[model samples]
Target: MIVPIPPGERTYRAQQAFEFAGSDLAGLVLFDDQLIQYFTGFIFIPTERPIALIITREGERILFVPRLEYEHALETAQVEEVRSYPEFPGEQHPLLFLSEHLQQLGLRRGLIGVDHDGYPPVMGYSGPALSELFAIRRVSAALDRQMALKSEPELSLIRESARWAGHAHRLLQQYTRPGLSESEVEARATREATQAMQAEMGPGFRSHNRWISGAVALYRGQIGPNSALPHAISINAVFKAGDNLVTGASAGVWGYLSELERTMFVGEPTPQQRHYFRHMLELQDLALEHMRPGRACADVDRVVRAYYEREGLLPYWRHHVGHSLGQRIHESPFLDIGEQAVLEPGMVFSIEPGLYVPGLGGFRHSDTVLITSRGAELLTHYPRELEALIIPA
Candidate 1:
């Protein structure tokens, strides 16, 4: 049976990060929304207003937010103090309040480790850098390294996420038809799968996104020739009988996520389509065979690119093999040509090697994988063969 993340997970993260920051620093200040959630388990919408989490070397945790989030922070933030300012760009700016609070916490004369120099300049709000107000050192890479490696509890959530994503993908296939618009099909399938998830997971389960309460599976406009563009935006185009479609599905289990994507067809595929689909599967197989513990991330990309080049399909290669995923959809240690990070046990990756033929369609499959001591463990259980993915015209 799958278990939810332990209640003390956030506290453990905070303690580990503080230990990594060392005693020389006054504290560690996190301005990134994902980092705050990683360290505190307090999920909040990121907007023009900035929120911060401060962890002192003494293990004291403090959270600062706007007055609008004061009650929410008090109830949700895992911190000793939940301080709030009136608003953003108020007479006393939020940063000023943060500075004063830091001083009150005895952080006047020492260096503080920060994820970024200041609150990210998002949504037209700009202000003085944290360096302008206090002494700071950038330690974002250290945090990234810590978050890249997953523990047993984190993997449990991701495993659960993959299970729901597979269920949603099955619904997406069952709901697809030649005459319906992509949005109509997606809406019907997502609603039914979400209802099923709610029934099965019980009331204690909650999605990471405030708007989406359960699993999501979508085509994202990857229909017919539009699928040739790897990142095609959804235009809600209608499905056609002979259309080659690409689809994606994912679900958030308390901020942990898993990716599952596939290339499928609305009806029987042509001979050329079958050839490309088989080649795409072979390329992905080559990459997966090379993915093992202690292997460099770049090696996987290199192997896949070599196969594409040998088959004269390099022009169709649009992106890298895949990327790591967890609290965010995309994370570090990417399977790219230049990444030097070695594959280690506990690192989870989305193994996707895609080929997009212009004016034809895209053929690709993505699955979540975990690096184990012996080899890689596949997490997403969706069928990959073309025969299994075909839909009736």
Candidate 2:
């Protein structure tokens, strides 16, 4: 079952951001879906129809949506005022109404912080840019930084997300076997796990087909020698005995997610494969050991990379050790060699160190780790030991 945030907290985030700014910003407008969800806990179908949230300095707030979506907003949005317009491109630009309201509310020419990277794109309609409507500032980065610190409620969701994602990984292991089609195995396992989560999540759960509140059962499941490639899915690949499997699983609840990954062998693994897997697991542990509050994100990656080089495994290292996670799948403050963001409490990341040898499959273990006051906490806790990952013949 799902628990909705109290109306008070729904608006607290936006107000807190404004309070943090302590500047000349007059109001905040949220048009991007991620921002909309983060600010209001409201989810909507993203059609060509444009929707927006506006907050004025005096604390006047409004949600502008298509007339058709008016009732949906009324039922779902925690907004005190919901102002919707007529059909799209009929005879008016939607921004016209927004502009007129801000003017009527005495906010014309006021500095409005928009929750978008740049200009808000009007999909399937023609409209003047928001800058043409009012003085604007990009506050997306500030919001990103603020949201990186997970609140207690957000942490609860992340924990649940990990549980669901870990369950999916277990299902993936159960459905996999020699002679099974990789596609068929993944499809069945994903369906089964998603259905189970839906059934357990209950009537209180609000689910949308989109990412919000959507739990993935199987995101990436590759088998055989082709699994050696990290990113590409092999075409017409078949699972076979003695083949190595590079698998990935995700559990997302309310847009927050945790990733779980493992390198599995369909049968008893060869000695050479075991050797590589052992080193890969150790590398991942080294990265985890370096995780703590106040450490630089880049420094951690540098240490892990140097270990790989010292071990003569630098050529097999592919991507960064990890990256921050949030409403979007992959957010900023990445754990790359050059990233300068400092680790902090409430920040979450993936501790995935991989060594891919072509024709031998990728050897990697991944878990979403949350930075805490003490140290790193693993969210996705599925078996990573080589023996635990073996699928008996």
Candidate 3:
């Protein structure tokens, strides 16, 4: 069962949606089959087949679902009108039914904003075809751009999620040992996260997949030139006494998520591990120190790259400094050279700097951060300092 969003929250989301469409007279039509999996809330389930449609205009909202699910939609979703299609004859298909319904509602013309990219084509009416029939112009990139900025309520949800994820990480650290398999450590982390969410927000706020826990225990193995390469799943190897365990956990509450990653040494670390760990931490601090309003994301990247180049560790450092996080784990406003998006208040992103040495393993530290007027505020408060867990050999 999904929890109902407060009326005020719906109104806030609707306002943002209107701004995103770039018109005061815009409507958002989300087909039932759309993969709004990233959207936080229980009103809509993740579906590969379109079975629902949501239409929103200035001061008006409507939702259309199959007759059987009409009651559920009304109870869970926020909309002015909840309608079903069983009443219509000759058209069992939802798209055709919706088109006819829109015509009846006098919405057959003007600018209609359909989430073509967000919805599944098989279940919903194609934006172009609908435009041809209704003489409506489809708005592109408007909705996505609007969703990038986080509102107060949205930020609150994200902060809560991050808090739970931090607790999970602490539990994981306590349970980790030299002999523990990567899978075992990951399982414990997932359990910790699940318990945290249930304790804080209730069972309604649970993840659909194990991957949502986003807890990965990467044991020391071979490192490569590309630091991001170790971030891949296959690189998670066995644990040893002197190995560095790079682990992170991500938890989603309502539809918002916070991701955290850190490097932990098992027992005592070798000189090489200690050296690279300090270097990665330094790089992370540098990225954080450079973050501020009006600063180009690309400039932050350049500073990080310059530091690595000066230390002759450029090859090990690959990928961007970090990226935006919210409803989606990876959103827009990426921190890289090609990105020209200026830093703005209320914007949240991650700052992860890593060093990978081939045949030796990897070292990385990641935290979700929010860009404020004065500086960046770190959301994930787990320890990232160079420390060794004294596991009995």
Candidate 4:
């Protein structure tokens, strides 16, 4: 069962963190979609039009949005005030209205904290820098640290997402065959998984419409030799016997998500395929064992790299071991050589160490895991053994 974060908890925490930091911040003005939604439960389609959420030092919540989203913000945003601009690139420009609003709130001259110096130029948007209008300090790192540590409620939702993603992946394996197209198999598995999820989760459940909607599993073109590319686009080609495939699966529980990926073969895998698959599993196991509270995020990757180096598998290593995940698919405190962030008990991560061999296919399995005081706990529960993943010819 999914647990919802208490309304206003996030904003309250943000306010407290700011107060404790002693940055003398008057308040925070957020422009990033994820940050806005983190502080305010208001979810909207981010477009060229700019949207901002203001949280005063006094904990007063104010929202600025496009006129088209005014009503939606009022109904959903957990803010005391909802303000709207006429449109994007209007004669006055939305930033001007936002400037005036800030002035009216007596924050124009104060060292207000912000996620960005100006609105992001998304979808061909052009605008004046927030610094051009008033004083602002970048405080995005504070939020990043806060988000890296997932609350109990947030973990619950992510766990729920993992549960559904596992169901979808199982369906993916059951429906896949030598003759079927990857697109058709993925669609069929996703449809069944979504229906089952909706029925079981009841009416209060809502789909977070980022990536694939609701519960979904996809190959993303990771079929045959194409699997060698970690981030491949779909080939829209049919599956053939002896082809190795890689799959990614996930389900959105509110805004939280979990990732589950696997490598499977249409027919019996060759001896070489089995050899690489076993090594990949061992690499992942090493990564998971090294991950724990108080360990530097870089340390995890270093250990994984050492294993690859010792086995002469460094040539096949393409990416880092893993990264933290939550409201967004990829978040802060990544497991990379340069990252200095330490793992915390509440952090969630996608632990995947992949190896790609040209002409053979990719051998990779990704699972969502939670860092605990003792070590790490697996949130995604799907079979990872090669035998279980093999499909009948």
Report each candidate's C-alpha RMSD, comma-separated, in the order given.
1.6, 2.5, 4.4, 1.4
Candidate 4 similarity to native, TM-score = 0.97
Better of 1 and 2 by TM-score: 1
- Give stretches of model 4 more than 4 Å off: 1-3, 17-22
Cα lDDT of all candidates, in order? 0.88, 0.78, 0.65, 0.89
lDDT of 1 by residue, 1-393 (tens): 555556587677777885556657888888988888888778898887889999987667899999999999888777778988898898977888999999999885789999988899888777779999999988887787778899999999889889989999999999999999999988988888888877787887778643335789999999999999899999999998889999999887777889999999989999999999999999888988988999999999999999999999999999999999887788888999999899999999999999999999999899999989988999999999999999999
Residue 177, model 1: lDDT of 92
In candidate 2, list every pair of residues with a backbone clash: 213-254
Name the best candidate (by lDDT): 4
Better of 2 and 4 by TM-score: 4
TM-score of each: 0.96, 0.91, 0.82, 0.97
Higher-ranked by lDDT: 1 or 2: 1
Number of the candidate with higher TM-score, 1 or 4: 4
Order of candidate numbers by TM-score, starting with the best = 4, 1, 2, 3
Candidate 1 residues lying further than 4 Å off, grouped into runs, are: 1-4, 19-23, 210-213
Which sections of candidate 2 miss by over 4 Å?
Answer: 20-22, 58-60, 117-126, 207-209, 212-215, 219-221, 233-236
Clashing pairs in model 4, backbone N/Cα/C closer than 3 A: none
How does candidate 4 score on lDDT? Answer: 0.89
